[model samples]
Target: MYAVYLFSITWAIVQSLPQGAPPSVCQTLMPFHGGGIRPQGGLSPYTIVPRRQGNHIVVTMTSALGIPFQGFLLQGRTPDRDIIGQFDSSSVNEGHPLDCGTPSDSITHNSPNDKNSIDVVWSPPRGYEGPVIFNATIAQEYETFWVGLESDPVHVTKRGANDPQFSFPLHNNGPTPPNYIPRQVKQNSAEFDPFYQGCSVTKLCFGSPANCVESKNCKAAVAVTVAGDKYDFELKAESSAVWVGVGLSEDDKMGDDSVVECVKRGNGIAAFMSYTNGNPNYGAPRLPNPQLGIQLLNSSIQDGAIYCRVRRDALTIVNGKAFDLIGKKYNLLIAAGSSLKQSSVGFHDLTYLASAQSQALADVSALAAKSKLLIRLHGCFMIAAWLGTASVGILLARYYRQTWMGRQILGKDVWFAWHRIFMLLTWALTIAAFVLIFVELKAWSGERNPHAILGTITTILCFIQPIGAYFRPHPGTAKRPIFNWLHWSIGNAAHILAIVTLFFAVKLTKAELPDFVDWILVAYVVLHVISHLILSLMNCIADRSSERRVTSFPMKDLGGPGRNSAYSDRSSDAPYSNFRRGLLAVYIVIILAIVIALIVITALAPIAESWTSFKSAVAPTNAN
Candidate 1:
């Protein structure tokens, strides 16, 4: 009996030992690659390996640099399913599907003793065996991350065997959809939980959700479900009315594409509206009959986030209009206002997305590059026309107006003529830039920011100056001093405000400006300040010289002073000498040179190169 018990214990030990001689492990280490339009840094590398332990199959992940990360996701499916289609439809952040057979645990961290590696074990569906395709994604906390796939998938069998030997290559899959949207499930509903494993894209503004906030404070998210044909969206903001939508085309500027939209009011009422665009222009009204099928599923407010979920058929036929969304790319548009009754004529933000991971995603990158170039050009032109040219005009009137050379070389009215010419050019450029921005944006919101308010004020001041000049009193009249004081005050005030406006423009558009533009602005400011100081010093010296002459001579003859003495006083009244005049001319020339250089650097050369490179990179070989 003792001998029999010993034999049974030995048999149990043998059975517990790893079977099949610890199936040979296949390991592949690949560096993280690819980035989005926004600037990001410090993405970590990932290592993939497949092996068998006991009776279960496991895939282990290791960080090359031993970095702390949020989590890692591993997805696998049978070889029969379309790999790309499965990838596009898989849930990424939450509510992952069981269609591919769920992992034992979706996220795992490094072991306590080993900070660089983590293991994730996945269970194959019962009765399923061999040859599976897999993909992996790694995310870092608030930093850039990477999504990698085996170039030729590593095929794993039931015994932890793989084919083509693990060669995980870094693939560029444009921007990953944002992961912030909460995965929504109906209460007590029988429908399967929607997968959040797919790529997501989101647009959001920042503000308090409890109080009505500007359109800039809104946010939106869109994602495709594991089913591939359904799309989910969430819109949140503080407003009386919020509208979220998806357009049929990649360009957000409205056009002849099907639109699916959801509107929510502050009082928690929600409605879905669909329309087929009749014209490309945003101002044009939608077609008379609105289509259907958009449904708002759930909504709630928590911690100043007004959250709402809406779902729709990605591709469908409704009201005789075909809405094709599968394997196609499009843009998402969002609009919100403080007043619930605001018209649906404007959008606050726009983002781009593709139904599947494809080259079509490059369209967003190309468009962004073009938009940056436009913004940079607009900023440079405004600086040259408003600040640079306006400064030259003011200096010409102040220092050169009463000089002997000014009256002799250009005659009495030429200085004023030159000033008027410069002012006219300033107005022309301002009008052109204003038109360009409005044309590019297409729609406007009523919420005013500090930059917008200042812009409006500067524009008003510009118009007021010309009109004020039209009513100026003639020289030598009783009210001429009053006119001179008013004109001087108004002109100086306008110039000051314009300079302030240019500074804010530079600050706001820094993303579009090159590294050197800030230095160029600083150089201009330094030169301008120096020039003004020198002019003030010259004026002070001239006044002092006239005072000394008047005190020494003391006009002895009757009639206060002789004609010769009066002539001396008049000549001494001149504010600038040849030396000062030469300096002023040099200052003006230097400023003009800087302005021209800035234009060439910011607008012409960089924009041309950027546009050329961006086009080449994103231009598709064949339209999808």
Candidate 2:
């Protein structure tokens, strides 16, 4: 019994609400569905030939309006500028009966504005002539439904194929010569009410005079009055204010849903429909010029006036180019909560301009495509170039050591034979290589090429190791210690710079081990380290052997001044502790440096992120 009572109450509330007022984003206007041309006079060449029936013309209208409107009106007058015939729907008075002889029987009007649509027929009065007038008007109140159709001894042109009358633009009269169209509303004003622009403070009441607040939650409302030949509409804000201007949508009620709903949801809208002082109705895009279009949306509806809020976006579309408006219009429909409203949204008529300069569009579009491709290529080249350079040095070092160069420089001890040659060659190559890296990085990084500068400087200083040996105070000189220090400093700087450069290179390149090249690089580094360690051990052993031979002979002791000690008396087989220890120390230092180099490289490389996953094995001691 309780559930049944609750359901009954819910149904009562639903039934009590207005038919077309349920917070919809958009709705069709039915009562005042006709429109008229402005200036309220002057005739344009136009003729309407009824295909459905003689003396009766029927036209279907699709509104892009955000809300449902009142019914439409169809009017015609004589050529002598006298009213001849007029048709009104049954609900012109918002559920009231029409006056005598107006097609009252055709439509079944409902009380409180029932009947969302209506059909009406008219009979022309005698002695009427002039161009016919037609329009739509708002029926928010029966008292404000006053609108005009036409005034004249109605003019008519005989319909013919290819005739000037038949050639009239789909929704326009014969084109008026330039400079002939009158400009009435010259100054653009954002404050003007859209629906009733001509209304003064005395004519309309906004709200109570006391606080001037419509209500706690109420918003401003705007009214729009558009007059055009064969099309006229008087739209009012059922919820918010209306934006009135002399732009396309203003002249011909065609507005985008984004603008409408964004405003209806409570925002300011800008109107850019018709011509105004220093502001035309049409202009080029991406240029420094005044925007020539109306961009206003109905923001808030309150009292009698519909307040219009300005929209920042100018509603634009391509002419002579069909865009896939499916997604765009779908989004608009969803936002506005209405379908079939997009048709009435006005489009720019650029058929003439497009036809004249069709080729320019193609060029502009091609340029844009090419520009995007260039940007993509530049990014790709930057990484590939740097990595390629570093790879050259690694590859060269590996090749030289693995082949004859390493053997020649470190072969059997002679008098510092190939060491000098190998050192010179390596120094020359390094200079040239570093210079190349520096120049390229300068270009890539411009003024802030710190990585390039540091790497290049370090590489140059690294060659000092060989240079120090070449100029070692002309052999057995006192400056030998000084040369060692110079060599040590240069080598350290080179190693540190190389490590730093590799790190920055990794960052700049966003390197990863996903590619085959990265795997190859890792393999090369491992091989280089292993070869360096083995060769260093061999050199240490050879040095110890030579030192033992020299020490065992004891040349200073054998060749004394007084006693004649023969060279043959000297012991040649005994090992020398000092010589062995000195050679072992050098070997250990070399081994340690190689290990350190490997560690630093691995830590700085792009694969450093995987360090935590790597396992280190520890040798277990066997217990008895």
Candidate 3:
């Protein structure tokens, strides 16, 4: 049991490393003796030299073949650093040995003409910068280079106008002639090289060959310190599948010849393509693959092997008319250059079976999108409902101020009538919105995500605000000032809750609005607030104009039943009951409108999805 537990822990640690992650890296060594890599002059495969300096391990290249092998020392580094680094030959272009493309920079101890003159350097981790020294020696292919000390420390700080500088010399063995090197270093170049342009960033490096447009290669490595505290990253290749255009495949199809997908250690894209003349233009042929495209996650290919490099991030929509991941989704189609008619040896149709888990995930994503839209619609309706009620309440309050019937029911100078009506409407709308939120919560929680928690909080707050208001009343009335405070505070709180809930609704909908739409919403909200303020000011001015003087403290006028006639005398001789009744009718009509809107919204909601699906199904063909 202990052993099993130990093994499990060990495996977990290893698995966490970049090498254990997806897009595995493989290291293959090319021998100098009678191997495919033949340099200009015949040379015997000499002893392999090896050494480890700090965190970096180095190996010296030797040859026994008739000609010295001029090939690149391909190094593979896993993101996790499980397998810190490995040296190998080019997976593609096996016919010729890998060699340094013309070097743009001159490093000391490098032989200019030697094809195998290659060394890799990496920056140390962010905080624990340490000695940048690396040891190098020669050895046979069987005994691979191993890590000595996994980490070391270095000192780095910003110094104004003080450039950081360091230097090291490569050891020279028995050569009487000084190593032939270019007088000045040249910038490394490779066509279709992904890493060279942005060498220091997360992506891999690429360099182009001057003479060959068809040949492209990339290199990548990550910095690590001795402490191993830095986070390691997985080396990923772009999609492994390529989308070949119908025309290109027909024009370049060669019998038993296929393009091979190649992934450099740290590069994001998968393969190198010759653009000179083989394909009309180099790079991806722009074929469409939905859900899957040309990407090689740390993959390699041998010479004369043809294969599609499909990208995993490819999500096609509308039958290739639209790319879901507009920027990243891509594929490469490679046909044999030799023969245009025959299929290549590595021809693979770009199709993958969807696993049950993946299908479930897809379904969930689709449903989430739907839920977001529903919430948005509900929130909009709720806003309209609440505002409509507020409008009616305000109108009702004004009618009660001067009406004869209102005077009998609510005494003159009664400021609470309109506010009372407003409260009732506010409570009603809040309750309805809360119920809608519950429904949304239930729908979103079929699989239960964190967002449901936010929904629950929103619902609880919705209910609490109105309940607090139900027991609270304004000051200067029969009730104490505490009630007024509670009423105002809770009312404001409820308003804030409503706004928050609407925001959550938008989040749930995941409805991405264009920039213009966002700007329009902002403008509309600002305008609405201004209009409400203007209307409120007008209502307040009208209220002040209608304020009646309470000079006579007549007991009969204060009494409820007789107060009507008494107030009527003071009402400028105007009839108020008919006006009050008309206002009441308007409130009723407003309430009815809200009910009708709810029904219409519910009925129309389902149609939106149906229309969307129908359009999605038909639009792609039309677009094509």
Error of 2 at 551 (Å): 13
Using TM-score as the yardstick, the better of models 2 and 3 is 3
lDDT of 3 at 24: 18
Ordering by TM-score: 1, 3, 2
Model 2 steric clash total: 102
Q: What lDDT score goes with residue 503 in model 2? A: 47
TM-score list, all predictions? 0.45, 0.26, 0.31
Please give the distance, in angstroms, between residue 565's alpha carbon in candidate 2 and its true position after superposition.
18
Q: Write one digit per residue (lDDT tens) for candidate 1, span 1-624.
A: 423433543343333221211111011111111111111222335555555454444555555556655434445544543222122212122213222223232332221122345454554444444465545545443123344432123443343343212223343333222221212334421112111111222211111111111212213333222112344454444333354454454454545555545455554536455443433333313334433655655454444334455556666665465755544655443334332234343433222221211212212221121233444556666777766778887776665543553343245444566777788777767666666655655555222335556766776777777787788765445565566666677777777777676655543422223556667777877888888778767766765865533221111211132313523433333545776668867987888888887776656533433554455446665343
Decoy 3 TM-score against native: 0.31
* Alpha-carbon RMSD to native, per candidate: 19.0, 27.5, 22.4
Clashes within 3 Å, all models in order = 12, 102, 81
Tens-place lDDT per residue, model 3, 18-91, is 12111111122222211011111111233233344444334343433422332222222222222222222231
CA lDDT scores, all candidates in order: 0.45, 0.30, 0.31
Model 1 / residue 410 / CA error / Å: 7.0
Q: By lDDT, who's the top model here? A: 1
What TM-score would you give candidate 2 relative to the actual structure?
0.26
User: In candidate 3, which residue ranges exceed 4 Å CA deviation?
Assistant: 1-381, 385-458, 465-480, 500-509, 513-524, 543-624
Please provide, for model 2 over 165-281, each residue's C-alpha lDDT reduced to its tens digit, 9 standing for 90 to 100: 211123433322111221134432223223333322111212111111112111222212211111111223233222222122211112221122222223332233221111222
